[model samples]
Target: MRLFNTNTARAGVAVIRAGSLDRSDELDVPVHAWVKRKQPWLVLPKDAEMFEDASTMEVLFKLFAR
Candidate 1:
């Protein structure tokens, strides 16, 4: 299995820290649904702008609506 080193892991953490929402923030499912594409799990900004880091589960749920 591929392993993530500290630097990469920390980078992911930085993304979350830069996000606009908190753990308790309720996300709008339909809005997220609009962004989920067949080829990609979720759509990003025009440039695939970095979002404040979210958990894998959080990101997946938003994309898949599970």
Candidate 2:
């Protein structure tokens, strides 16, 4: 998440939170939203795509290759 924020700060690129849209792990915790609340500048893409339970690299490529 910090990576996203840092890159956005320096490069002005859109932030895409790939993988599970729930932003939580198997533990059912609200991880992404929690981080967003803490770092309000961490912008989430309006078209953030949710992926099935799969490899993160797959999701990342899917997101970036657009």
Give the candidate number with the greatest lDDT. 2
Compared with the true structure, all predictions reach lDDT values of 0.38, 0.40
lDDT of 1 by residue, 1-66 (tens): 222223464343332221344642454332222233234565544544233432354564454555
Q: Which candidate ranks first by TM-score, i.e. highest?
A: 2
Candidate 1 Cα errors over 4 Å, as ranges? 1-55
Q: Write the per-residue lDDT of candidate 2 for residues 1-66, one digit (tens) a residue.
A: 332332433354444454434543333221233332344575544555433232244454454576
TM of each candidate vs. truth: 0.19, 0.22
The alpha-carbon lDDT assigned to residue 35 of candidate 2 equals: 35
* Model 2 per-residue lDDT at 18: 44
